[model samples]
Target: MPVVDIPGSKSITARALFLAAAADGVTTLRRPLRSDDTEGFAEGLAALGHRVGRTPDAWQVDGCPQGPPAREADVYCRDGATTARFLPTLAAAGHGTYRFDASPQMRRRPMLPLTRALRDLGVDLRHERAEGHHPLTVRAAGVEGGEVVLDAGQSSQYLTALLLLGPLTRKGLRIRVTDLVSVPYVEITIAMMRAFGVEVVRETVLGEDVFAVPPGGYRATSYAVEPDASTASYFFAAAAVTPGGEVTVPGLGEGALQGDLAFVDVLRRMGAEVSVRPDGTTVRGTGSLRGLTVNMRDISDTMPTLAAIAPFASGPVRIEDVANTRVKECDRLDACAENLRRLGADVRTGPDWIEIHPGASAAAGAEIKSYGDHRIVMSFAVAGLRVPGISFDDPGCVRKTFPGFHEAFAAVRAGLPG
Candidate 1:
């Protein structure tokens, strides 16, 4: 099988762009993801007058750790929520005001929480089209960051925006959070911000809804992105779905900074023989799939593959703690539930959860709709291998993360028994 390394996390890429734009002097990012989301971040940074140069190895981002975006930005964030969220705050910290536009898909995503929070923090930002969404105008103004509260359960990106930009604000932010989900992602942001010389201190919680970031700015340095553990779950899970073979993802060792790396434990729970190495991990199919109940608060992306493999299990596989799933590229819980039902699997969904009942093997090979979500396309495509000749429409949608997702699936599938 042809083995390839997926670029670093798109989440990391966005954070890196924000870091580069917010850092002093030049910063080099190694192995950044080069997808639409990251590209949009780069474009937005370029509009803000960061000399983000693309190289064969890594990107060289010339930057300044000071107030005001160096230039006028006519940014098209497209469907990248990170670009749509983080860039606005960075723009608010810049030299002059800029106009921010987005694609139709980007237009549909909510930016109100971040916007409202920014407005409360004294940002002179406005909505061009919808009040709470994209097509935003980032006016030149200083953010007087002090205390701000937001409903983070909708999406943790808002919290991330504040944390990343907290140091740049005049007062430095002390945030009070409510309904904050996807905390692992926030932890990643906190960890990465610390890596770049920013400080996010969490004091004793007054209640469950509060967090504190101490006053400090970010440091500039070279950084490398770990290979994507979330993408690796598919290949490892593929080994379990397709019997008689094992798949290994190298370079994803134990104790990764990315929270999505926890998917390895999920595969082990489902009866896959798992071995974790300092360099990577391997998963071999066990004799039978067992029932599982998992709360995927930290590792929601793994849900698609886990759910796809669920129908082969001995009983129901219940996935919980994924209210965050609803606000992803698409509604992953509904997508998994609805699509599995199409294949005659007993699937049920909730506002934020999913359950899959084991069932007979059926190769209907119907055209699966991706809804423009990459994980849905690949996870179901893996399930397609369980039934021969199953294919997907708009399979190219996987380029959002795992650019070679289809080819990688094919390479591994070609090695399996018929």
Candidate 2:
């Protein structure tokens, strides 16, 4: 087995950008993830007047709290959802019209709840094309902070939008969430904000999604983003499900704010040895894996890795508590099941759960389909190392998050052919 060390996560990078942009001083982020999404953020921040630079493994952002005064302008996020959602709210803070649009992929994402909530509180944004979806122009009417309900079950980005814009609003914002699925991501936003000198107080209402954010711009600070736990989950899974070996990931220790970091526990339960480090982490594969049942509500980003490794276990591996996985990049649960089935693993899936019967090794060189999802491709590609003749439909899709995912895979492989 080969040892692997991957770069940090885009999720952490994006959060770092938000924090850096809100801070008053220049923030330097080391090992920041580079991708279309992060680039879009840099572009969006530049549009709002923040000076940013995309350097090797790091980013420099100079933030001005009062600079991006909302103006009558449109910011096109292209295919970047973070940019599409977060930039509009930032723009709305100032007095002016701003329109947010995206490419075909991002254009299909639902934005109704955020828009409706903003409109209700007083954002002057209207869909130039279809309602709920993008291609809309904002008339820049400042929304007074008030109670707004959001259906975050579709995507956590909507909730993140409100949380990010909280400090800029005149009054503190309280959002009552209904059917919010990706609650962990909200916690991620809150944790990152607090690191950069902003805090969002969360009050849990049983059977409801309710969160509150105080009024104030994120206090500018030099905050470094933690390594991406989600990115490390795949390699950790690789170590666990393999016949023998280990993988070490740095910068993710015990009690990381990222919900996906909990995936290490899932690995340990499956009989893998996990070592936590101050700036990194390590995972060693146990010779054999026991099929386990798990709930993934908090660690949905690790769904692909867990599902890919499930078939290698001795018993049935069942993953539950994550219906939100259906919307990311693609219908991940459905896609993983379909592709794994193609590779000769027996798998069953539900709206919120998946049951996998582990017995045989994945077939070699099956030319699996990625469904245009980067996670699907990356996890399954790692699976291919164990299975003979493994290939992906769109090997290039990993650029969405890990721009050098293949290189990282190759880096870990040492001499293994890509």
List residue ranges in candidate 2 displaced over 4 A. 1-5, 67-72, 205-209, 360-363, 414-418
Each prediction's TM-score versus the true structure: 0.95, 0.92
> Which portions of model 1 show Cα errors greater than 4 Å?
1-4
Q: In model 2, which range of ten residues has the least summed lDDT?
A: 409-418
Clashes of 2: 16
Error of 2 at 55 (Å): 3.1
Residue 277: error of model 1 in Å?
Answer: 2.4
Q: What does the lDDT read for residue 412 in candidate 1? A: 80
The residue-level lDDT of candidate 1 at 362 comes to 55
lDDT of 1 by residue, 110-223 (tens): 878889988988788889778998788877766667899887878888999988888887778888887777778898898898888876777546565566665556678998
